[model samples]
Target: MKGSRRAVVLGLVLTLAGCRKGKEEAPAPLPPTPAEAPAPGAPPSQQQALPPDMRRALSSIAPLVESVKAAVVNVEVRDAAPSHQDTPWNGEGPDSPFGEESPFGAPFDGPREDAPRQGLGSGFVVDARGLVLTNNHVVEGATRIRVQFPDGKEMDAKVLGRDPLTDVAVLKLQGDVKGLPVVRLGDSDAMRVGDWVVAIGNPFGLASSVSLGIVSAKARDIQAGPFDDFLQTDAAINPGNSGGPLFNLHGEVVGINTAIAGQGSGIGFAVPSSLVKELLPQLEKQGSVTRGWLGVAVQELTPDLGSALGVPTGKGAVVTEVNEGTPAAEAGLKPDDVIVSAGGHPIASGHALTRTIALEAPGSTLPLTLYREGKKQEVVVTLGTRPDLEGVASREPSPEQEESPQQRVGLSLSDMDSRLARAQGLPRAGALVTEVVPGSNAERAGLVPGMVVVEAAGETVRRASDLARVVRDAPPGDALLLRVAVPGGGRVLRALTVPKQ
Candidate 1:
């Protein structure tokens, strides 16, 4: 029994030894490398990495703002009248609303004391030698004009030229102004409606004020000028903000601040800079703007009018009247035909058609698209130089004609005839209303050229003389009510009050 027990103990001890050997045969862990170890006293914190593509885009447009800020300038104009100058419309005067009695009880007769009128506006240097760009309204009739730089340097500026029609003017500096920062011009034609833009101007005498906004709209016609293709924005432009630069994100001038919606909360407008580039050469050469003329009166195509004229929906201006011996007549473009496109650009409106045609150099052949009686056609017209009415014909009436009572309604009126109505594109024949003089009685009567008079003074006037006799027969009164039939079929009742004689 002792021998068997010793054998069992030996077996158990062998099993234990096998277990210990297995434990001792286990592999050891490898030592840590220096590269994998954390820094002496610091531990890793949570870190996020940006994408590679984002880093590249941020670097591209970072310099644009800085480059644009250097070029914009603030202009201040001061007009010092004579010390004895008459005070015009003083609100606190006896004739003013704030004064005693009716305030307006007395009429202003003579000039009173005068004070110097100071005006503030913005302008930008367009040339390195210090030629500045500003609105003509800024420095017009001002005795003294000064340009304030972004660096706060004030220099006296001289008006180089002023174009009131376009509201654009150039100012040249007399003093030393070398190395002036000039804004880079951008192609405004490439801008879209929603593109981001910046405006730098003086609003309410605040100099070098910068505002950012997107292009709210394009080709806005405020009717401020013939070439009024404005860029509308919500950039907080005010009265003194005129003649400022509207810049794109690329640090280039895309538009010029010209006008604003009256007392609006945010609506502002800028003239396109592309026009400045186009007119700058002509302004520099002749101190005036000269554009090509087709001598054709065109009308915009309305949906109903387009259908009646058999023109496509997207067609161009409709030639309502072609002047005799004009380039339009010479080009075989007749009345009622639509000008679809010009010079490879689609002509959508009468304004656009006129603008594109004006862009072409005088005597240059312009490729034009036309729609005639539902048929598509094309014509090449050689544009002609515009004629100057002031140089060719004087507007002053002869002294002998002064015996006639001057019409105070801002219009010169005559009775309409069927032939004249047809020439004016009237759908029906009626007594014609001719020329409206500026600030004349007929003008105040809301009478426009080419209007047919169906009734006047509660009587039907069949002839121009009959209408004139009615006006001559009526005693001076405050109002004249006339029921007129429109040529297009609708009957309109117009009430025109006579101006106090």
Candidate 2:
């Protein structure tokens, strides 16, 4: 059965090739008495020829492919593999949620300790002066790097700059780097779904392989990084295709092929060219990117949450917590403020706000429109340099020595005294939740033990009675909005539905 299938597929390919050849304007003359040639004026066999309409639709993109193939190159790197002791797993098992491998390539096998690990990936020239663009993972921690063009010419290269957050890297070729072929970057924002695109790369070490497909989706968050706005494509991106170009029909590079779905075929992702364009200047000059910061944690305001907060649904991001001594706090931006716009751009979600802030320069003052307490207000804030969040750790709360009677909402609350405050790494105020009943309103609202209730119904809750009083005064079936101080340094809002007595 397999052999028969292969024969059928091979025959189809040859038929397509023949159709393409027949469409060419210039044709080679054939011998007058050639054998196996179809007679003139005779209808072509249905099994051997495609319909006219189908052949036209499959018109060759040879001219478009030829224009951009020269800029594409193969990237080779050699780095030392880490030993088991140096691995980040730290005794975690495969079932752990963070144990999944990166989608860019196959998982690294355990090699001999400090062994040289050789890798292959694809890249393209973006400037005539030998500047190349590729994925940061391609040459990360490499002891040696080489760039090989489609013509088999090799040149040593060095990392100009790299941004791991977006998985983009820029390289500079060594030696005489004059008049190199470059690809023109296109606007990824303009590429719509189902638009034709071509991919050129060295998949699996096969140099200069080409594949064709369309944009499958946009703005996909695959959890690859904090800034994970990837362009999903049906193009055949594989292990060695990382950092290659995804070109549009006009021969303009739209995206850099980055990763692929491990268990699925025809599902791949690329970094949009628009984002790469924004980083090119800094990557070339400063050798790194400096992102502006607004020290605040935010959450997406769903329709129900928006109606409860008296704001438009799906319009803005809700500020969950404002860090102390930060630009947000200095500008009087408080928790529960809905950010509707920033710097004249409308903020649609938390991710949008984050990306906007990160794109701005540090120390740049920007205007922000916010909805606070059902009143619209505008504030100007000076951005700060983003701080490293990797070192921030959440402390576990100690066991509570006393327990209160369960409330109607299924929460046992107590006052946050000095002992509990120090243990939980929180301030000495608010009502602390000692217990939460399973399958109850509080649990359904995400109320868990160790969470401190800072405010209830827009009022401060310094003790258990303060929270109970607000809950009691609320009408049945109404959601009691509560601001909670989580175990970490951030705060979150939860709405618990009042039970009918």
Say which candidate scores most in TM-score. Answer: 2
What's the lDDT of the predicted structure labeled candidate 2?
0.73
What tens digits encode model 2's per-residue C-alpha lDDT throughout 1-72? 000000000000012233444457634434433334456667665223322334324457776777778888
Give per-residue CA lDDT, model 1, range 1-501, as digits (tens): 000000000000001112234347633434444644556666456323323232122323324555666667766654333221121111243322233311111221112223233456777887887888877656554455667777787788877776665667788886788778888667788878867677776666666666767778899865554566878887766656678888776677888776654434566777688988988777666666666889899988888889888876854798899999988989898888898888889888999987787777888888788888989898888889877633311321232432112232333345555565565555343456656544345666777666767777688767666666566555544566776665555567776655332
Deviation of model 1 at 294, angstroms: 0.6
Q: Worst ten-residue run, lDDT, model 2? A: 3-12
What TM-score, computed on C-alpha atoms, does each candidate reach? 0.58, 0.65
Q: Which 10-residue span in candidate 1 carries the lowest summed lDDT? A: 4-13
Residue clash pairs of candidate 2: none
Q: Pick the candidate with the highest lDDT.
A: 2
lDDT of each: 0.62, 0.73
